[model samples]
Target chain A: MESTANNRVIHVRELVKKFGDFVANDHLNFDVYAGEIFGFLGANGAGKTTAMKILCGLQRPSSGTIEVAGFDVYKQSDQIKKNIGYMSQRFSLYEDLTVKENFQFYGGIYGLSATEIKDRTRQMLESLQMTTSADMILRDIPLGWKQKLAFSVAMVHRPKIVFLDEPTGGVDPITRRQFWEMIYEAASKGVTVFVTTHYMDEAEYCNRISIMVDGRIEALDSPAALKAKYNAATMDEVFIRLARAGVRSMNG
Target chain B: MRIIFYILQKEFRQIFRDKVMLPIIIVIPMIQLFILSYTATFEIKNTRLSIVDQDKSTTSRALISKFSGSSFFTIASYETSYEDGMERIKTGTTDQLLVIGKDTEKKLSRKEEASVLLVTNAINGSAASLMNAYASGIINDFNRFILEDQGPAGAVPALIAVQSRHWYNPKLDYKTFMVPGILVLLVTLIGMFLSGMNIVKEKEKGTIEQINVTPIKKYQFMIGKLLPFWLLALFELMIGLAFARLVFSIPMEGSVVLLLGIASVYLLVVLGLGLLASTVSDTMQQAMFISWFFVVIFILMSGLFTPVESMPAWAQNLNRLNPVAYFIQINRMIMLKGSGFQEVSGLFVALCVYAAAILSIAVKRYKKTA
Candidate 1:
């Protein structure tokens, strides 16, 4: 079979995932294009995380197709791993390590040279304007700084796609704004952003958002268009309207 | 090349950053190795004896002088009479009392035998038995010379006589027997305890997330963790040995290299046990508890104080499972028997099998789990 290079960084078709007869994802389909902020907007237990786990090669899909960054997730998992970065909700980084050390550890894992890590760290610390705290341990830092530092470490390798599983799950608006700025910087560098989040305002920042309902993508489009099409004022309103329609559609 | 160094540097930095747990990594083992080695012994102490002399003759006095001159006892007190010595036995302070009755010298001259009175404190029974044995042995030696007419030449007066010699350590001070085995137990237990828990801590703390997703192979990561601790165990062994040499003046009778060679194999088995433990544990605290539980068993079964043969037959069989047991045998064989590899191969092979089996299982488990 021939492979096509598309603007889509991730292409899924009829993705079925089961957990011992419990269908977590039922025929899920979505496309995340390159250099775009793809918001996985879904309610709790709507299979958004399940689909993301499959995309990240954490869990095997029961049956269906998954193409992440020109690599088949099932067959070319190692290749998929090389071309992407993953950060979990808990912000997986050595807490005992300093900000610079965490950066070095992650960079080393991704096969970057020490010089590259040093230069990149300089750039990251310079952009954050927190050069003085480069050597400050991550556990000692505030949660806001920790969030930003985690994002920086995840993007340290500059992979084609970065998976942020609710990267800012619990943080204030200012910290959330700073986090999105870091995401924006990564996306501007032509890195595709596949992020899962509960915040409606953050969903608005995505170029395209997919609202999952009952293990399927109920709506996938720009927030403005989804809101306008549903005659709703915001993505939250659009989500509620689509969720209701999705229920009624199921009933019908 | 640079990447592995970066990871190594980060790990070392983190190990040092935890200021509280850091010094314990080095100093605790050293202090323990030095202090505890002195405690691991088979030598019995604080024996008490009561003497009653009814025959106040010079010969009786000369015989009593032999007991008081020895270092094994503190002659608790001298009873005025036989009844008093028997009374001293009830309180258990004196494990045994010797009563020499009147006409003790006349009975020997007349070729008629006279029995000595030996009152024993049976409360702490084993000490009483050993004390009686020593007292009887010294009296028997005195009787062989003084009571018999054969004089000094009687032992070798016969034409067909044999001479014997003592080897390795003739004196066989309990400290010489103890030092090597203690070195094995401490090194094996500490290495197993600390190194096994090291990776388990990383796994619990989620530092392993970076390691698992990295291009570094499982074997490399496992080696990097285990090797430093293996070396540390040996370092402690060397330090303990040096202290034993300088302070206790223990003679290394056998080949030091052979002892170390067997010890190195024994260390592999212990380190493998540690790795197996780490593979099973999910937290440092759990690893610590599990290691301590094994250490207790290891010390008991290693024959650090008592002979493995002297234990129950089932316990002797159980001791075969303990790697520390083989190390102790190898240590004593090398240090006391001055034995070669030929004499110690059985223990070395047992340790080899344990090392290979445990290390293989641990590596497989780590790869599958981590």
Candidate 2:
């Protein structure tokens, strides 16, 4: 899709993030349009998390011009934070708290009114078919349910953009598919979704995917286009081909 | 401010929800207060005394009766030989041996100076010194009585008397001294360890990443985190003060309002230390270790168990940085001495400055961005 300034939810340019002498994100550039499911694909240490963290205002870039939800990363990060929701790879909800309490807490911090929080929580629990488990502590629930609940909690405040850092990391395939459906439903409601994952098949669900190799975006295109460009049969083959070639060039 | 309320609500829920932690936070410290107050004492009571009376004179027997009458001593064995009495001390059956030389009455008749020997088990130096002091006091009293009896009753010679009176705690009750200091320690423990561990737990559980990504201000998050424990510490102090009055009968001589006011400022110093520890540590274990290191040093050097003046010069200087030392001093002054704000104002100002400096550094160090 052709993107305009009005439709762009995230704009990153020449973004460079360094840790002392090590460059974790090197001169990156990307733009995410409104309601788009953008996949950030990289190896374990390929700087996708670093870039995502910067976009979410959880970390500052060493030198860059970056904007999230129309707010500058450095100058207006607080504003940016208000307009975005984030779920880390590690579970973030309080395990000792009941499911409903977690919803109230997150929504409350985002300045949602009590009635709004209650209404949203009820609707979310109904849609997730977790109405019966509202009073149950998070630790007692299964991992898949916790992941799904985490995503719903992230959307409790109806953020303009929701950043999911490998939200479906350790779930079964069926649960992962269910999670993607949730993402799709959120996107259909015009919420931009920024996600990072290693699952090649999951990348196919994104509107567009960016592949990072060695702190640099090696490819940015739709999954079909990437497959055609790399002349690979599957996204798995395309990822391996790009990663190996990138490693070879770096070695040489 | 409403956001802070929500954060505080969440923190209180989590704190109260933990089955293991709730009791540990509430009940354990009160139990410690009871145990430590009753057992940790400096007063030497019922010290076992072994006597060897070689002189069977009436004056020597009178001296033996004098020691037996005193409440501080328990006459365990009466041996005829000095070596037998010394054996009682070596065997730990007695704390000290009192040996009276022969011709004790004859020496008095000749107007000669007679000396009684006291040998104490000095293994425990402080206890031994205290035992020696009690024994020497009895001997001196007996000598005075003998002089009075030998001299003309109506024409008694004038002698200078040293009258020593203990102020604040007239009875010299160890509980009275210990309860206030121990109360400071409990409050500091609750403030420092709980606040520090609460934040680092978020880090360990990866929940801090979620909080950091939110729009909550740093000071709001910190206040929310520290306020609950601060209040809890104060509540603990109140409970401790009640126990001091009802159970230990420790006098609350100063104004309760003034004590609480100083306690609130002191809590800021401890809570700020906790926050600083949390900011530097990435796990609950690390935070606990860091807090324990400071707290153990603070409590030991705080003059809770011993007098601060007796410590080495460098240790006394180092205690200037110890928040526990300052609070313990303030607590003792107000609770025991009935000291008002005017008396503790210098220390109070120092605590206020410390609170400001520590809290500012903690807030600055606690970065929302990694």
Candidate 3:
């Protein structure tokens, strides 16, 4: 198929990452279009984090032609960083800071003016119905609220892409649903969502999903397409089918 | 510049929010200054003396009385036999023993030379020299007393009466000498350990992952990491100097501004060392251990408790690179000797060079990309 480079926010060609003799990403090829919820599905040790880090400008790729937001990873990582937001399973909000303060800090570091940070912080607190908890320390907030606050803070700069590395790993189903709704809202606003999750049910929420097995992309298609291709009834079955055929352990 | 200010704001907030750390950073060092100054002394008091006078004459008794009257010596015993005086010294009951030979008064009356034997415990060599000097001073006083009693007409002038004037600290107060050194230590510890552990704490908690992904420059991050502790260390120095003046009555011989200016550069060296430690270790424990290893070395060799002049030549040469040593030396010179900027400029320049080297190394080692 002919590729549409203008529509793609992320382009990875012949991507390879290695740690010593171990290959974490083996010559992967993919493209993620703008404003799409792209699910990067993998078991533990399937090089999910290594690839995410490379894309986030937090790790160097051993060898690859990877571009995010139209900036080369090797030469223009600073530009790439300026145009991306990141949230992780281990939340990045400072526990010592108030909810409003956390928003202000992230906004300030992202090069927002003081007046802009002040305005955005107030708007964020009001929108989340967290005006009452704005002054409350993050450590005192409920975990679900903290996760939501972390997501909002990560998006404070409104970058073109947001990388979510298992962003809802330990949340209840209701909170996870709420978090996915936030992702969808962001995606609707022309923000590309690149997320990784262990939940097969959550994987079904993506527009396109790629399953990696043993440092290589084993399948790439929509949830229904992948299920049909694997002759399976559920994403779990599809995942299990591919995972069992792999040699790398979940602990790798 | 703006990004670095954000980091500084975050660090200051976190530091002040920690209730346990606030007191540890400010109060503990003040308490240490008060307690350690009084106890860290070199003054030797109450040297126990034993004397065996074989001559049993009035002259011998007068000489013995002189030793007993002196405040430096406490006459432990007046043993008649030499063996008893020797036994007292061997048992460590007496620090020194004086033995006056037979017919000491008869020899003086005949204008012949007289002799006395002085023995001291040389285990502590410095204290032993002091004890020997005190003993000889007492015996010389007795010789003058005898000559005056024999009706001499303002006899021959004595050999070289050295008029010694101790400048600055005329009283030779060890507290005056030690207070400034301890202040350097407090500042160095606060600057090094706090900043060192701060970065590693973020690393251990995985907060650095988000920070690493940010567009902030490396120098901006390092400046943000260092500024709070650098300011805090200077504040701690102020408290230390205040205590030195009010509590110890340590006179501020030089300009407080000059002292603080030098201390500010010294803080860079210490805080830079902390940043260096953080870059080498991934965990707070590892960072603490690494910083502690160097802190202990710097403190011991800082000329705080012992004179740097007395240390072996190689150790002293190695001390040229030690920031603590330079700070301690500069602090004492300024506080005790009333030294001017011109006097401390060499050390000040050395510290600036050292700080620049270490901080640049730390910034270089700190990886934005994992």
Best by lDDT: 2
* Ranking according to DockQ, highest score first: 2, 3, 1
Angstrom error of the Cα, residue B2, model 3: value is 3.0
Each candidate's fnat, in order?
A: 0.44, 0.90, 0.71
lDDT of 2 at A234: 96
User: What is candidate 3's CA lDDT for residue A166?
Assistant: 91
Candidate 2 lDDT by residue in tens digits, A3-50 = 898899999999999999888999999999999999999887889889
- Per-residue lDDT, model 3, residue A182, is 91
What DockQ would you assign to candidate 2? 0.81
For residues B159-242, what per-residue lDDT tens digits would candidate 2 score against the true structure?
A: 898887999989888998899999999999999999999999888999989988888888788889999999999999998899
Error of 2 at B107 (Å): 2.7
lDDT of 3 by residue, B200-319 (tens): 999887888888888988888888888999999999999899989998899999999999999988898899899889989999999999999999999999889878899999999999
What tens-digit string does per-residue lDDT give for candidate 1 at B1-370? Answer: 5554665666677767889876776677667766766776545455677889888776678678777866566689988987777777776667778888898877766767866777767665665677767777677767655644534555534444356565666785667777777777778866897678888877777656545544466666776677667766787777777777888787777888887777777778888888888877888887788888888888887788666878898998888889888888888888777788898888789989988888898888885223
* TM-score per model over all chains: 0.82, 0.94, 0.91
Clashing pairs in 2: none
